[model samples]
Target: MLNLNQDPQIILWALTKDTYWHPDDHWQAVDRRCKELSTGEIFAVIDDIVHHFVHAPVVILTGKNVWQREDFDQILGKMAPILPSAIALNNPRLSHAALLSRWKDLGLTSVYLRLQNPRTLHGRQTVALAEAVVDHGMRLEIMTAVTPRTLPWLPGLADLMLSVGAASWQLGFNESLQRSKLDAKTLEQTLVWVADFAATSPLRVLPIGAPQYQRIVSDRYPLLDAGRIALREARGIAYINHHGLVYPGVNLPFAGGNLRQSSFSNIYRESPTFCALRDPRPLEGRCGFCDYHLTCGGSRTRAFRETGKLYAEDPGCWNPQTA
Candidate 1:
């Protein structure tokens, strides 16, 4: 079940790990919260992230599942050469061999399907869904959001996902911005349960969009001192929302610059807000004093949300000394 107030020191790498995909959701909008990107803007942002050392070539494309434009394949054709590893999140409505063959032709290495529909993950369709991904020779990563309602079922869900041949399962904790949040105690317990359960499971269980827990990710999460605030969210796992508003992540609403006017690299490297986040001088509390501040500065987003300070102590951390 749930472990209470577990020692975070012994299991830093067991929980957090490096994210292989750079989430570029706003690139192409599908609905109200989604934003569309031009062909020029797409390449421009990719160039920016790589040049700025903010991210690698691999990117996570989230937004509209369906790419209706005929030119969509053309755009991917251009990026395929530069991006060797690209993961697209798609709906699991169709799992036929023909659809799988089509996805393989699109230069996609992985297809992330959300297991939100209880019927999909738990129903008889589970086996078929897993077979479609595996038979297609594409890595399958299943994602599901963890909310107050879903907390208790997470452990069982992870097991079921693995049973279906899911290569990885991403448990996304609900965001306060979405009118949902799990308390620190409950969150820690949940993580402990996951880490313990997945420690032996063949399946890879990862926190959705979180890099702060990299230390606990076994041997997977790199221990590079790459400036967590900038690398993980701001620069590394940067978020460019619809309307071209750029931030380190959603937690910090301050826009670095609009993608419409300034280039992504220029905005990422030159923006005062972004630059300050990369700088380690102003970090406060344990993050400021620790040697791991550059690489493990807790979560700037969480700090901003809880303390309203760019460099404050992370509320999720009970003993900064353990870090």
Candidate 2:
């Protein structure tokens, strides 16, 4: 069930810094170093979220290669009782059915596969892993970055994910590693295409760091009925990096507070970062003048990346007339 009351519903936790497949040189928003938190540290974060937040958030376990750690299964076993969680991995070893069965036994509701290089042999393994995840009665999600190289494959990719019984497919832009080659018109066209695709397909298409998608799609679909994909940063989502630092969203790098120092609930309710992100009135330029500012304030991460201001207009937003 999706939490529709504006309380936090999703929390992304960077479980480890060790990556097994490829580095996020072309996609990550902030550069993360090699640092792995101890099981105690992980448990403390989980407990804070459980005790502080108004509701139990669906914790999404993330890392470059979370499965690289030998004790990860043990860690998951301990964390499951506190809150429901899902795991994301980039390992080809996930194609094995036994491993998926083990994760199912561990009480994971879903499994996310980060398909970075979907044009290579790793892509094939990801497909196999997706099938195995569904076969084992666990939900499967495919997450990939939208780059110049990957853009052309999206239509086909959507078809592939649908064929494999994937529950959702998330597409996000490259924020820091490299400047995006895609322009405003290009992005708008892409979102329009996705909007059209989503209306008829059963598979959910989610866009990260591109909240403008909501405004674009709202022209055709009812905004309230658009599902959780319409939700934006600080509205019902938060991110915790490997160091236990909390942020408004996955791509938004501004930190509210550190779990090691303060309670998650206090920071979430009182921090300037969280407060600013939640209230769209402070946005400047086009974002402030747009009619959909309250519900779809253009991506704050993209604004920061392009203009060095968190509240600046999204450079990729192609909306001509301002409200």
* Candidate lDDT (C-alpha), each: 0.56, 0.74
Name the candidate that leads on TM-score.
2
- What's the TM-score of each model vs. the native? 0.70, 0.85
Report the C-alpha lDDT of model 1 over 149-195, residue by residue, as the tens digit. 77777767776786667888877764332334776556666666776
Candidate 1 lands at a TM-score of: 0.70
- Candidate 2's C-alpha runs over 4 A off are 1-6, 18-36, 68-71, 91-98, 116-119, 176-178, 223-229
Candidate 2 deviates by what RMSD? 4.0
Off by over 4 Å in 1: 1-35, 46-55, 85-92, 95-99, 116-130, 209-212, 215-231, 242-245, 285-292, 320-323
How does model 2 score by TM-score? 0.85
Give the lDDT of residue 111 in candidate 2. Answer: 87
Provide the clashing-pair count of each candidate structure. Answer: 16, 0
